[model samples]
Target chain A: MKAWLRFSTSIVNKSVISDIMKLFDIDFNILKADITPRGGKMLVEIDGPQASESISYMEDKGIEVTPILKVVKKDTDKCLECGACVSLCPVEAISILDDWDIDIDNQKCIGCGFCISSCPTQAIALME
Target chain B: MKTIEEINQKIKNGDAVVVTAAEMTLIAKDKDIKTVAEEIDVVTTGTFGAMCSSGVFFNFGHSDPPIKMNKTYLNGVEAYSGLAAVDAYLGATQPNHDLDIGLDYGGAHVIEDLVRGKEINLMTEAYGTDCYPLKKIKAPITLENINQATMVNPRNCYQNYAAATNSTQETLYTYLGTLLPNYGNVTYSSAGELSPLLNDPYFQTIGIGTRIFLCGSAGYIIGEGTQHFTEAERHHGVPITPSGTLMLKGDLKKMDSDFVRGATMPSYGPTLFVGAGIPIPILNEDIALRTSISDEDIGCKIFDYGVPRRTRPVIKETNYQELKSGKIEINGREVPTSPLSSYKRAVKVAEELKKWIQKGEFLLSNPVDLLPNKGQLVKPLNIIKPPKMVCDIERKPVIITHPTDPVKEVAKKLVDNDINHLPVVDKNGKLKGIVTSWDIADAVARGKTKLEEVMTKKVIIAREDEPVDIIARRIDKNDISGLPIIDKDNKVKGMITAEDISRLIGKKNNK
Candidate 1:
């Protein structure tokens, strides 16, 4: 199971993620991360039968954990392919194809919502 | 040169070789302009962008009592009802006032609903008259129920537009999309080589009455659009400044929702995404050459939008090729670029236009009139205080005299009021001329005592609503110390002097 985790400045310095890893037999992979002295966000893929339990345990420790059902979903019917969302993506997930259609790689999207609000047409949405 | 009639005839016969501007560039690389012009009868061009000046006019068949709709709403969005009793014009950018949909739906959504064959809630309010007794009416309406539904756009398909970037330390949300703080990204809105106006840069083959593909339907160019600046600097007839726009009119019933979309920008309200395509008849070699223009040849200036002024300074002049490359160097930093206009949709529009022409469903029309090759210079709006003269008698009594009055009396009045200028008026109190002390002295030297003879006949008067800066400039240009302020009826209202302007400036500086 994959999820996006948000940590506040106080919790960011703490080893809550490592504590969760040790408490549960869960293998975690940091797909993407952005950590500042203030606070940060991370996209992690947690593997194990107790992935749900590990996420719950992290929530109990004051770490915000949101499970990722679909990272990003683009409404093609509403999309004008204006490329307004391409540059704001932290990862190079959104790109213009040869035909100039804006393509977003859901695999590379970290669900940052940077492209969502940046989109003038409001065609891109972050799906949890 | 081949005429549009000849090209249309070839199109009717399914013998006209038509290609999109993109396809024509490839053909032009292999063959000369003359050969390409001879082979191709028409070249299709297109643009898909957020055209804010778009609207749809709908003629809903009269109600039972035929109420004059003074106010209207379509799916909670207000539609302009100033046209006729039942006719209404729904602007693309009108926001949904009644619905708290987070500004997601608007007039464009109503248009899309109509295009998609969905019923829209039509509500109108009118003051009940004797003949039209109904005051308020609410009903569901569809495109089929309407007598006429046409998309009338004042401006579409700009030849070129500015690329936008933010220089400020904070992120800015503008019509150019989101501009990240500290020049994080640059955004431009144009289809580059695929744009319709770019392909017919000079308006040689496209003008009034020229048929076009508008949102998947056949439409016509009505005239040169609003803010159409044709004389902007050009490279190969392609404008570097935003110029050569087109006014388009088409039936909304025939349009597809896929091409015409309602777009809502965060905090900017609603705007229409219009897909426009114009097929240029290869009338001559020049037309062929113009159609073959590529992204490398078309260029525009990147403007810094952080200045928050109409006249923002240009950061750099860059071609469409560099813009399309997705990254540009701005202030020594590698800034990513995004296009607000969709080239894919533009290409799709062009291809669809070509198909329509090939199938004889569309025909090109010769221009009824040509757009002027030149445009007037655009001046920035000067911010100045509105002219408000002190009409109180304590400040300064306006020295005045009738035109038939003696020049000696005007001179006496000027001296008595301790003023340098006096306004000469007629019996009806209309300002006739202005007589200065120097003019009165000159007239006395010439042995003329009549006020009309002494007064300056060519007087540049300032209006009551005129800006102070413009009046000041007039005073400076004429080398005059004062000007007579007049009302709309030409009656002398008051007088403004250079001293008064300087006093106002001093006051402003103090603040």
Candidate 2:
């Protein structure tokens, strides 16, 4: 199961993921991480029989967790490919092709929803 | 030097060579302008950006009952239906007023849907008359069913524009995209090198009746755009303060959905993304030089959005090269920059236009009327004191309220007097604070009953004898609709509003 975890500034220094791994017997792999003193966000894939239990434990420990059940989808019918969403992506997931078409990498996208709000055409949506 | 007619004849005969303005830059760097002019018959220029002033006019075929649409909405977004019985104009910026997701849908979306050959839900209402018996009509309409759908814009491509940055701590969401707080990023919106007006800076080749590439179809320039300031300071024939603009006309049926898109700013509502291209005939050396202008030569000032004024202070004057570099130095800080306009699309448009000319599918037309060289000076409205009118203190007593007054009573007094503002004063007639209708409404919503709790303690006041111009400027600068006029003793005398200033201006104009 893939999930996105948000860590507040105070809890950012804690080894919550290691604690979860030891207590729940789940193998966790960090996909992407953007941690700063202000706050931090991490996209991780937790694989185990107790993945759901580990996620619940993380949320109970004051860590915000959202399951990665959806991927960013671009509607070719409505998208203008203006690249307005290219700069808003925190993970360089949205990029402009050689022909000027805006491409979104589903694998790189963390489903942050930042590009969805900034899109003027409302062409990009997080689809389950 | 070859005339424009000769260049057009060569293009018509497929004997002329054409290159994009961006390509012309590289060609001219190696050769002289005269040589480039003689070699290239046409230089293509383009701009792809959010054009909010764009709209489409539709002549909906009459229904069986022949209904006259006075009010119309396409997918809950309002369309202007005041032209004729069946004719309507849908502006790109019209919000979906009645829908909860109104901001997400607008006239631009309707046009895009139409261009994609999709049926649109149209709802219209009209008063039944003797000739037209229908009162209301709701149906699905498509481009094929409509008689005529023309896109007429008051302003299309601006020659140049200012860069916007935020110096405040809070993020600012504006037409320039999101401006990060503390000068974190800057955003600009011009196509720079590929822009039409930038290539033909003096309106040399582009004017009324000139054909252009509009949203993947051919369109024509109708007239000068609104606020076309041709007399601004110029460098290499391009004005820094958006000197020239174009009024364009095109057929909606011929436009492609790929070039024309619907866009919604979070709080600013909807706008249309327009992709346009124009071909400049290289008739002379000067025209070739103008088209060959590079990004290094085109510069725009960076304005601080924190100032909150029409005349924002210029922090730096940087060229498009620095602007496109993704980071620029502002006040010793290297701030990230973003462009609202798509340069990639703009280049694609220019290249496509060049291909059209090279294939002899497109030709150039001479201007029916050239734009004015000198722009009329915008005069500020002066504060003219009428001989019969006296100072603010000599006027009728202003409506006042006490701090001890109940919120309900203050609200009632405001409604009864049809006034939105009231100055709170003491028993000795000294001003204490002020209350507005917003305060009363907020108090009512919050279930507050005391006037003191709802009123603003720091009141903005104006002197009785102060010049109306200064007061009006102050009101405008502060974004306040009105201010309370006070005497020397800090007593409330009267009030002045934006309406009063407008009325004074109207009276002066009448005189």
Candidate 3:
């Protein structure tokens, strides 16, 4: 739970930190989110179900994931069968039309969302 | 059974608790609890925790940039506090701070003495204690970006003439010339420093080398070494037409080297323009607009409309009543009075008719081709074509004074008029020995008592037909004002001075 809290960089105020840390009675180290020019996204993973309630508690206190979620299409009927998106798709989720129909390899999709937004049509959806 | 008070007793004994404002309000029935909660609330918690899920959402609530953690100065002590304090002090003590700052920064010490005192000091103190409303967000500004604009001002050489002796107008021009090469925009006025009159805020930052061009009645101190150029547009309120006009070169090679494809001579008035056929001659419409009138209309308007404003009818003093009565004397015969109202009315009608005649004829005229030779619109006062061809004559008019005229009065007048020679003339207006500008100097040098006491009557004389160069050599050798251009009887045709040579040959190399 403390490790998950360390990944969420929302409380910049020292007073807020002391108050919230005292309320939960937990000692946690804080880190700044790695904000790239391309985007800034804070990721947290709970290893145990016991940490779920604490994660929910932190969420309730105004800690957020990536502020914006971009929805886009990767594979659709607009494909000219050039296979450019397929080759450029880092996760290999985009595939050429097998039988004149595009197939999205959903299991292979890393949910990085770049390919979805780069597609030329409203054919791919990034579920938030 | 344990009552609810027993559970509350347990909570008070240090059980885990989540106290909200509503529960705190119920506890706040006791003033002591209310005071305790108020003290504990160091910062206000946001009410829109769910709505403002992200910092971007907070930005959507207001267009201002997000208040990032790095923005805080020393644990939320905003940097604006110090800056605001300074701005407040400036505003209170100097309500006209924008204007005051310019004067102070310009080193205007007198203004400081006038504005600074005990009252301002007290106001500044009072202003400091007041709170200033914090702006939600202001765009970042850099000093370099702020100074990247041109400032314009009018300049009067007369007002600051004493101070300007050390100040160099040439330096101002040179600086502007340097900046022009770098494609920097600069501003100057034909009127005199305009920033104060225009209430320009950037006067202080405008720089010492800022070029100021005053073209008209800027009340110039005559000997202050101030000179202005003749602008292509006469709209600068001064009649300084270029002494020599721009001419197109006929030599094909020279033409190609001299001007670019789009190059054309700057035009003035209604004149015939000839150039390489590539870029044809343009009318006044081609120039910068303002008082731009058609080339055909310029001559008529200037000669007819503008001139008549000064010229008046020659109404003889004796005939004033007769002219007012609309009567006329024609060939020694008196005519019956017409029904005109007054002399003013007759003059007005005459002026109108003269304008009609001028407009009708003058508008159709064009300048004669002065090709191969650059033209000048010379005034008669500034030109003299001797009746006979004379070569190498001195350039200036020689002054001849009367030998009997009081030398003191003549010398004083000569000095006042800025002329050197005073040609001595008899009562009959015949020539005599010339008093050179240096003659007065010599009289002063020798400390002569009077004009008759010490006067130089000896002088070299030349005929009107003498080659100017020969006369020039004699004048130069003798170190005199010049030989008078006399007739066969030794009467003054005209007097030759060094200025005559300068007027002719000195300007030959110009343009």
Best by DockQ: 1
**Superposed Cα deviation of residue B291, candidate 2 (Å):** 0.6
Candidate 2 C-alpha lDDT tens digits along B1-511: 7777887788788888888888999999999777888899889998889999899989989998889999998888889898789999999989886778777888888888899999988899999898889999999999998899999999889889888888765566787777776787788889888889988888777788999999999999998887777777777778776677789999999998768888887666888999999999888899899999999899788998855555777878888888877668877977767677888778878988888887888888888987665754434455485422216323545799999999999989989988888999999989998899999999999999999998988776677655676667567656888778878798888877777778776777899
Rank the candidate models, highest TM-score first.
Answer: 1, 2, 3
Better of 1 and 3 by DockQ: 1
Among all windows of ten consecutive residues in candidate 2 chain A, which has the lowest summed lDDT? A80-89
Please report, in order, the local distance difference test score of every candidate based on alpha carbons. Answer: 0.84, 0.82, 0.29
Chain A TM-score, each candidate: 0.63, 0.60, 0.42
User: What is residue B210's positional error in candidate 3, in angstroms?
Assistant: 85
Query: Which ranking of candidates, highest lDDT first?
Result: 1, 2, 3
Off by over 4 Å in 1: A4-16, A21-43, A46-69, B376-511
User: For residues B391-453, what per-residue lDDT tens digits would candidate 1 score against the true structure?
Assistant: 421245555788888877877788888888788888788888888889988998999977777
Please provide, for model 1 over A21-115, each residue's C-alpha lDDT reduced to its tens digit, 9 standing for 90 to 100: 78898889887788888998888888888888988888987789988767888988778898988877778889999878889987777677888
- lDDT of each residue in B281-355, candidate 3, tens digit only: 012221111111111211100011111112322212122123222233433543222110111211222232223
Ranking by DockQ: 1, 2, 3
Give me the displacement of residue B352 in model 3, in angstroms: 94
